[model samples]
Target: MSTTIVIFDPANASHAALLPSFADIHIACIGTDHTIATFTPPLNRDRIIQYWEAQAADAVPGRRIIFMALAGDSDGQQQLAGYVVLFRPLTETGPFRGSVEKLLVSPDFRRRGLARKLMDALESEAKARGQTLLTLDTETGSPAELVYPKLGYTQLGIIPNYGVSPVDKRLNPGTFFWKQL
Candidate 1:
């Protein structure tokens, strides 16, 4: 199967159909106690779709959130293999900065380097938009924590008892990271 990364278009019905799977991936992450899922609330399929729809409509060059999906094509069918979200402030002033959120890959797609590709695309887009820094937080000791440093992100230290673990509902530490563009 060939996979391609593209900006998610909420206006497209085909694209919208991908949300349920995305939500499932999200829940799975949470269920696994991943850092990205720390403190994540319960998932609601309809609400998730609505939220993405609103986000897509509000997306702009710098001051908005954008979602990029890694899609797989097999025998003329497309499936969302993974996705990531990048968010930038809407203010007209101050240093340009953005944050990464909700990076997820389907279990079947793991070990295929899709997450790295998504991060690379996000950083490139942030730089193109003149963003000077990118920030993100992942659960301490999570796979993302390991990956961010490899991607040139500097650790900003770990916050103890930062959030409730989605899987166990117990307190867990969170690690913050930043990359300068």
Candidate 2:
């Protein structure tokens, strides 16, 4: 890979260029395939744009953390790869519960275990925040499907017709997975 994946808080001062990388990763993670199971809510770009702006400012309503994978080669001026965004409720009691909001690695940078590294960083963040349970969903055929299991995520259940298909315009079921940290 041409870029080094560095995990840092999005609240850092030098996050202007880094924001687009995070946005792109979020988009790539949710491909054009509507049938792919995802966590996207039904909203237009304006709303999402506003929401991300809030995220960039760490102004989201709940307990959330955003991480960016940047390039050590680009002098910290360019965004090289993907990012992971996770959320956990503060009202919950023992052991935190989390939703792996987003995880994506650039296509050119896949298969090098960056995703795992990002997840590791995210899990560490979650653990540090006192979260004990985390949940995320992925398409059955996507490369991500193999990742969580090896990382110790248990398959909780499958939700049929959970996503809309891009080709046929039909909904496809997605596999839900969770891990107890």
Query: Highest TM-score, which number?
Result: 1
| Residue 5 Cα positional deviation in candidate 1, in Å, after optimal superposition | 0.9
lDDT of 2: 0.66
Worst-scoring 10-residue span by lDDT in model 1? 60-69
Off by over 4 Å in 2: 1-11, 29-51, 57-62, 74-78, 93-95
lDDT of 1: 0.74
Instruction: Report how far residue 40 has shifted in candidate 1, in Å.
Output: 5.4
lDDT (Cα, tens digit) per residue for candidate 1, span 150-174 = 8899999999998777666778889
lDDT of each: 0.74, 0.66
- Number of the predicted model whose lDDT against the real structure is largest: 1
Q: Clashing residue pairs in candidate 1, if any? A: 35-139
